[model samples]
Target: MPLYKEIILKDNAKLYLWKITEDIEYLKHAVKLNTNSQNRVDSMKSESHQKGFLAARMLLQHIGYTDFDLYYDTFGKPHLTDGKHISISHSHTFSAIAISNQSIGLDIEQVKEKILKIASRFMDVSHLENLSETEKRIKATVIWGIKESIFKIKNIEGISFRNHIFEEDFSLEDKKATATLKYENKEENFDILFDSAEDYIFVCAFEKQ
Candidate 1:
């Protein structure tokens, strides 16, 4: 069995993390349950995708929905036929899912010092200036996660953390932050939440609109 850590935000969006060490059979089961294609290669890739899918499915199950449906849009954004919004992300051993009535996104990252070394490549000079050595490493991971969440909600790719990602002032004492994403002329506000559970840093963003 996998161990799951759940975070329930004050706004009601739920974030779930499953540290899966099980065999790949769960993946095969997921593919069989969701798709109709019987092509061998498609089945293989679909199975690979299921590590994240089953984790998300378990979360939906816990929330009291057994017959939920998932479909992807043209931009590869995952959506529910029942009208709920969902987002998923996975890294290494952990997979995460976030669901909400409104638009939401979730990302799980293993906290590592390497992220800090490469922070300048992803973060603007202003973002670089705002971080302190004591928290710079963790904050860098947070920005990486925020960028991912923004991408999921906006359903676009090629966004840079430095120029495209804009966020509210985050103090060292804050475990959460808010950000404003600028994709062309439009701006969307998102609330960011962070958790230092196990060896990973989990970040989630929910659109306030």
Candidate 2:
């Protein structure tokens, strides 16, 4: 699958989204890697992961980094070797990569109705009550995307969706939302850019300061 879009943000940040297709073998070949022994029996899973990683690395290279080595922090958040803030998220066959000088968080998820089942875990009463019935499910997915981005930026695990991840109202009219990080006693705000297209939705958050 090729990249669907490349967004250039205000501060030299780049957001790349790659479409996923059903050709698992082709994707594996694109990465020039053989499936791992454990994943050999599951070609689909292996290919999806490989393709996402390869596409992300290519984006990193375009920004002047030749080597792409990903290691997780203590919280299991993936980090780049040189300390740049990078976040990756993949759902189904689609993958997204976001990199910036400022700390960043990004997430990509296939738009699906299943999100409705878990909406309460991530959204507050106010957020939930505001959505129209038709829009509520879609909004749930968007909230999930924001939460994922928040998690990657904080590089911390154990935060619950209901308690920690909070958001200001997002609108399709404006394509923007605000998320807050409440840790200890301080609050930090981040801007969220949302793109919803053809069965998929992506969200990215960045520290404005």
Candidate 1 structure quality by residue, lDDT tens digits, 65-181: 542376677787778788877887877677777777788887888878788778777765356575676477777787888778877788777666778887775753577889887
**Residue 160 accuracy (lDDT) in model 2:** 70
Worst 10 residues of 1 by lDDT: 32-41
**Highest-TM-score candidate:** 1
**lDDT of model number 1:** 0.70
Each candidate's TM vs. the true structure? Answer: 0.81, 0.80
Candidate 2 whole-model C-alpha lDDT, 0 to 1: 0.70
Give lDDT: candidate 1, residue 193.
80
Could you tell me which residue pairs clash in candidate 2? none
lDDT of 2 at 70: 50
Q: Which ranges of candidate 2 are over 4 A from the true structure?
A: 32-47, 58-74, 81-83, 128-132
Error at 30, model 2, angstroms: 2.5
Tens-digit lDDT track of model 2 for 1-209: 45677888556678877776636455435443224412432544555676566655455445555333555556666677777777888776677778777788898888777778777667864665766776776777788888888777876556776787689876766778888878767687888888875778888888768
